[model samples]
Target chain A: SAVISQKPSRDICQRGTSLTIQCQVDSQVTMMFWYRQQPGQSLTLIATANQGSEATYESGFVIDKFPISRPNLTFSTLTVSNMSPEDSSIYLCSVEQTGGNNEQFFGPGTRLTVL
Target chain B: LAKTTQPISMDSYEGQEVNITCSHNNIATNDYITWYQQFPSQGPRFIIQGYKTKVTNEVASLFIPADRKSSTLSLPRVSLSDTAVYYCLVGGPPGAGSYQLTFGKGTKLSVIP
Candidate 1:
């Protein structure tokens, strides 16, 4: 298991502002992913942050709205651009191990509430 | 990606065993069943994983039948702390290259004292 941490554990932001969440893993990993959990709902994949490449955004999510950066194996960032009340949700980061079960480890999550 | 179906909620008393079943009719041969637990305001925690038969860890046990279309996650004993949402996901290992997890509406377990 990897120790994962996210910055800005909880924050309140005004509408139209952007918030960038940082995810840091204690060890190197192959794949990093970003997920969003709406209030009282299941998680939705925002994108998969690929090293040295652009992030793969899921359907209904676009790069311009939620840009992601994965510069190296152990770190990644997701920026919610031009936020709105609908964008208020818990953003989480997870890393996939290389071999065996390849179980993913998750960060605590960044809870953002856009006012 | 194989979609999963699970109960929306379950109720159990403390000290009693609990079993949650998940169904994935189109599960691929290489696909594995994984279970996760999530508390309020926290990330999901991996409980167990199995390709077939039974797999047990310190946290929970996964029972997969011969057809591999369904799985059961059995908790030996329940506690109030176990009151949370449980998720069932189906996918192959990272080697599959997708490396993405799809979370359904997990079963909410409420352990009463």
Candidate 2:
């Protein structure tokens, strides 16, 4: 198990503003991912943050809206750009262990509310 | 990714064993069955994973038959704190671009006293 932490546990932001959420892991991990959970909905994969390269965004999500940066193995950031009211959701950062079989450790999450 | 089907909710009493079955009719040969538990406003926690037969840990047990079409997650001696949403996922491990974990609505298990 990995101990993961995220900054800005909860935040309130105005529409059209941008917020970057930080995710820090206790140890180095191979792959990091970002997800979104809307109100009363299941979790959706936002992107895969790859080290030393551009993040891979899932369908229905684009880099312009949600840009991610993974500078190192233990840390990454996801910036919700040009936020809107519908962008209010819980953002989570997760890491998959090198040898683990489909197991992922998640951060506490950043709860963002756009007004 | 294989699609998973699970019940929307389940009701159980404390100290009773709860079994939640997930059906993945299109499960591939290389795909594995995994379970996760999520609390309110928290990330999902990995419960167990198994390819076939039975796999048990301190927290729960995963039972997969030979057919590989379905699997069961057995929580022994449930408690009130066990009330949460349990998600069942069917996919291969990381490295195969199986990073996207498709989450179903999940079975909301309420352990009543």
Candidate 3:
């Protein structure tokens, strides 16, 4: 298991502004992903942070709004651009180590409240 | 698209066993079933993973039937700490393609005294 941490554990931002969440893994990871969990709702996969390239986003999410960067194996960032009240959710980053069968280890989520 | 289905909630007494079932009708050949436990204000934690038959760990046991369309997560000797949400995840093994996981609405287990 890897030790994963997210910066700015909770934040309140104004609508139309942007906030960037950072995820740092203790060791190198094979796959890094960002997820969103709304109030009283299940998690939704936002994008897969691919190292040295653009992130692969899931449907209903776009790169223009949620731009991600994975510079190396142990670090990544997800920036929520032009935030809105609807974007107020808990954002989490997870890592699946190499040779594992998708038993992902997740970071303590960043709670974003857009006012 | 979510790939698994589970119950909405359950209630069990302390010291009793609780079994939560999940259904994956369109599970692919390479897909595996994994269970996760989530507490309030915390991220989901890996509980168990099974491809077929049964898989057991210190925390819980997973029972997968022959058809592989459904699986059961058995928690022996429930406690107040076990009161949380449990998710059933199904996805292909880590590989070049088909590695991302899709989560469904998990079952919320409430433990009674």
Candidate 4:
């Protein structure tokens, strides 16, 4: 199990502004992912962060809008650019343990509200 | 990624056993079933994962049918704190081309006192 933490537990931003959320893991993880959960909706994977390389994004999500950075094995960041009201959601970071059990552990998440 | 289908909501009383079932008709041979619990305003927490038959842990037990098309997550003597949204996830083996983890609409368990 990994202890994950996210910065800015909750934030309120204006439209067109960008917010960067940070995710820190206690142990080095090979596979890291970002997810979004809107109100009354299930989680949706935003991207998979690969160490030292570009993050692999899911369909319907673009890097220009949601850029990710994974400089090391234990840390990553996701930036939401040109935010709008539709982008208001809870952003979470998760890490898959590098062993047989592929269960993913998640962070508390950063709640973003765009006005 | 195999799409999952589960109940939208459920009601249970404290101290009762709760079972939430999920269906994944297109589950692959290497796909594993996993469950997660999420409280309001918090990230989803891992509960259990299993490939076939039954797997028991300290908190929950997962029962997978022989066909691997459905799975049930059973929580014993659930308490009020256990009231949360439970998610069922299916994914193929790591590094496999079809190994994409997708979160489906989960079952919301409301445990009453």
DockQ of each: 0.68, 0.62, 0.68, 0.61
Off by over 4 Å in 1: B94-96
lDDT of 3 by residue, B1-111 (tens): 337889999999999999999999888887888899998888999999888999998999999999999999999999999999999998866553456468899999999
The reply for model 4, stretches above 4 Å from the true place, is B94-100
Give one clash count per candidate, in the order shown: 0, 0, 0, 0
lDDT of each: 0.91, 0.91, 0.91, 0.92
DockQ, candidate 4, vs. native dimer: 0.61
Better of 2 and 4 by DockQ: 2
Q: How well is candidate 2 docked (DockQ)?
A: 0.62
Q: What TM-scores do the predictions have?
A: 0.97, 0.96, 0.97, 0.96
Predicted candidate 4 versus true structure: per-residue lDDT over A21-113, tens digit per residue: 999999998889999999989999999998989999999999999999999999999999999999999999998877646678899999999
lDDT of 1 by residue, A14-115 (tens): 999999999999999878999999988898999988799999889999999999999899999999999999998999999887774757889999999999
Candidate 1: the clashing residue pairs are none
| Deviation (Å) of A13 in candidate 3 | 0.8
The model with the greater TM-score, 1 or 4, is 1
Best by TM-score: 1
